[model samples]
Target: MSAAASSPASPAALTSSSRLAWLDALRGIGALAVVAEHMLPWFVPSLRPYWFSLGVYGIFVFFLVSGYIIPASLERHGDVRAFWISRFFRLYPLYLAIIVLVLALAWWVPVREAVVRDGSAVAAHATMLLDVVGIGGVADTMWTLSYEMVFYLVVTALFLTRGHERSGTWAIVFAVAAVLVGLVASGAVFGGGWPAYVSCAVFVLGLTGVVLGRLRTVSACLLGVMAVACLLLSSRVPWLGAAVLAVMFAGTAIYRWERGTGPLWPVAVTAALVVVAPVWAIESGWWWVRADVWLTTIALAAATFAGGMALRGRRLPRVLVWFGLISYSLYLVHHPLLKYFVQVSGDLRQAALPYQLLMTAVALAVIIGASALTYRFVEKPMQDLGRRVSRRCRGGLQGGGEARVPGEDAGDDRVLGHQERQVPHGVGDHVGQGDTVG
Candidate 1:
């Protein structure tokens, strides 16, 4: 979920924009990896490889990006109410659009059987906590949003309490929890759909109070508790849920380390624990979960992120940055669009290898083209609207000083990890005195 607002106004803001592009680029790369993981097995089976799961690798990169970026966002803004409002607009417009689209397309492209088609599903989607609430997403790719939402809630709470700087500590805690939980809990520990309903209620009420500025502190604390509990009790794979949070905070930990405010050792420890997390779990049956391959995937994602960090000062490939620009749209629409093609074209795997390759290229091109359109018409407009609202709110709160943040003037955001599109800010900006930065 990242986008640049417009061009920067000053030399300082331009430097901020340039450094942040690598993050958006990572998001783009991650989204395409996810698209390939979903696309290849269906239409180009022979080309699909299982050694390193493209989907998981992509998701990890996103998790890290969001972890690194979100703290800066909330911290710099320093207003929970405005932060949540912006997040809502950034994430929901396209998200709800896709949800409805998937549901409407169900007749032609039947909804995945995993979807529960009930009140629970409704509750889960509303909170964007589908996976943690033990509910299937209407859009198959939406599960990751659950973790992103949880991170937001938890980070907000930390910011409210001024404990936001302990990211490295949280990373290790979650990583250790991942291994511990994996041994004993493979599936949801919460028994049924009731957790979804209950948590949904909590989410709605908590947000309502926070937004309304009534018992705001209490509401945020409760929201954080509810989010963490949901993660621990109801995630489809308990350990993976824990591990995902760890990955996110690990991103933050890395950012802190880069800023010279935190230690790098915890990040290393967190990585080691997460890499070995699946090795002994009862639920570790997926081929990609194999110790060696999982380690490779985890290492590769880190390396990719690290590479971006290393090359932050230098100008990157225009194509990579362009990928970042349309990343959110690409992430959300590609899968369902692929399914629509599968419906029309049938399995191209049965055709000649060249035809399969050609059709795959065609499908990819169409997806990219479609994504570009949605980015223009849907995502960018909503992001701009969200920022305008944020500006008004901020002005009202601050009594008229410039409360602008990086990527605010230029459009950019959370990768969707959909952390949503149009980043509020990215890593490497000078620490401005503001809200607990993303």
Candidate 2:
């Protein structure tokens, strides 16, 4: 399909309902940033400032986007079962394939051990419990997945209790409130260890923005400012709360006063953050910029939000859209692919830069190819099967006059459910397919 053709189905088609292009673009950018972060060692001896900024900031954008998109989709469908079904069908097949590939590569690669840590990271990653215990996956990057799952569970529980609208609202309220309370409770000033809470809150924040996005220009900006403010307060900022308030206040001013909303402002702001984050981090001299580093990530998250705002309802090229689609697969497997490639390429004593760059490019190309293959032959087929099974199971439930049990209808479709929409290829009632950066 042409790039334009691949832009998600238009919002006009859905009438008042619109597709969020910013989120898709942000997702694409986030995934690409992650891949690029992995590839950074090859190009620069000391990591570039921009690369560092993108690395930390990129994940926040992923979290924010995920917060907005997943619940929004669930609300769109309204059927809890269908929502879960869609999520699973979309994420699992490709995830499973990656897990298998990672396992296979374990025997041949040494760096893979560093990424996975041991068989446990793989096991933890496989279970999607990486964040709960904080061990993460072999990929190291999959830590976000753990944070994401906790939010999903929160959403799922709420959905089960109340329908999407009420539950989503409550989820947001509770999440925001919980974040505020957690900040107070932590007594760390900037809310230490609140990434877990921020994970859930940001998703709520994105959801809140989605709920209020189209109401009016003011409302959109207000909500966006609120989200940014919450994030600022949640992290370890240099000036702490004051800086957060200043940025949000300034952002609000832009929204209120700035006329002529073209893509440039957002693009500029986003680009600025993208460039500045790494430089600032290097300057600060923080080693890894742990959970305390959320201050740094805010700009990328905001840039993504701005990008999402700009792209709303407009289509980009199809190929870019597909990249967004298979991003999860690409993300899950990119670590292993790069690790193996780097290890093998180490033997080439030629100019390390050219050799590494060439290999990185080749690895990325292979990842894309593998992702496409997985999407076509694995994800799509399983998703189809899942939908069919869900329909059949739903029909059976209605016919038999009984409620459905979680795994009662277990089938290939379990891998493709709507709520199963994001990446955990393993362990969940249902998983979502879209957000893969974690």
Candidate 3:
């Protein structure tokens, strides 16, 4: 029987196949775009005007993919304990590894100390709620992880409330709210001492909700409140943060429509709103507006997602698939690698164009190689351990009986094995699955 048959809550059966090659390819492409967005400006300043903020495009694509895949994962499992277990194993190992490496490197590099000073670093490490608490990330790239965590909480709320199918409607609501708030709000909604306290409270309450799965409805409502509050009130850029969430839900809406779980109109409306929201949210005469970068980024992200949908069943290149496999590691490790490289090598903007390009290429190669090792040694092993632990936990919960939904275990063992081993791919929330980078 397939893992899903044996454990009906496991989405691994759906996610592990080669059928999702297009999504994997999109992840690989996004990973490259993010790396370029960060590395290019340093090496080719002149090109910065045109390619500035390409990271925005990369992250938008990441968020969309995350929105599409993560909810499916949660709903498939239909068990909060299993879902959280998968996520913890998928995300934390590599994340903790990177943080430790960054801190250790900081000890030797003066420039790195900025990440460790004050209580901010400790808070970030302790909670992973740093950005929501109005404290900066230990590494600049970590800000996205905070948003990813909130997305997970919000998804959990929807799941518990049995309202996940209405994701498209939520997308529209968030987008509209973002526009209105952008126009009227002069500053952050909770820009005071309350942010940290509120963040901590939400974190504690969210954990409690997960643990007390019997009170799912109440837990869901509480999580929803916390998530919405954090997004609207505590974010450094509430409008953009809300817009990002909308875009992610828009992706989720699209997935629901494709899977026959939702109406198409919401998806259509959400796509339209998301395309315009970022542009609308920006203040007039901002650099992004002046350069028309916002429009370009949105357009590129939309096109990429659409193309992936179009080519959903086709096989992608092995290299691209490999890139997707290690994309999360790439996202996590690349920024610090670039930071340290630039710090050690000094500014290379004054160098010849060829030399700058050469250095950029070298930096990318190193990051990729390092990512491969980490994926093999860290990500894969930890995920396997998570799977085993989840199996044990499920067995215990069910009094040693097979924990499965009815009638899902008739599949052939070979097919089940293939399905079970498929790695869930995406970026935005879970660094390995759909998490963020710098």
Give the TM-scores of the predictions, in the order they appear: 0.88, 0.58, 0.83
Which numbered prediction scores highest in lDDT against the true structure?
A: 1
Candidate 1 vs 3: which has more lDDT: 1
Ranking by TM-score: 1, 3, 2
Q: Which stretches of candidate 3 lie over 4 Å from their true place?
A: 1-16, 49-52, 110-121, 192-194, 212-216, 278-281, 289-291, 395-438
Tens-digit lDDT string for candidate 3 (283-314): 54444433366667677888898887776656
Task: Give lDDT for model 2.
Answer: 0.45
lDDT (10s digit) by residue, model 2, range 1-438: 342343344332432222433344555676777676655544333343432345655555565556545554444444445544555566556666766766676667533332434454444444353444334355555555654554444444444444323322333333343344333433223432343343444444543433333222233234344333433343223222222222322332232222222112333343333223333333445543333344445655576666765666666666655566666766676766666665666532235566656665677788788767866788768878767755554432111111222222333222122222233221111112221222
**Which residue pairs does candidate 3 place in steric collision?**
9-77, 16-422, 427-434, 428-434, 428-435, 429-434, 430-435
Evaluation by lDDT, superior candidate among 2 and 3: 3
What TM-score does prediction 3 earn? 0.83
> What's every prediction's RMSD, in angstroms?
9.1, 12.8, 7.2
Query: Over 4 Å off in model 1, which ranges?
Result: 1-14, 280-284, 395-438
Q: Assess each prediction's global lDDT (C-alpha) against the native.
A: 0.76, 0.45, 0.64
Backbone atom clashes (below 3 Å) for every candidate: 38, 42, 7
Ranking by lDDT: 1, 3, 2
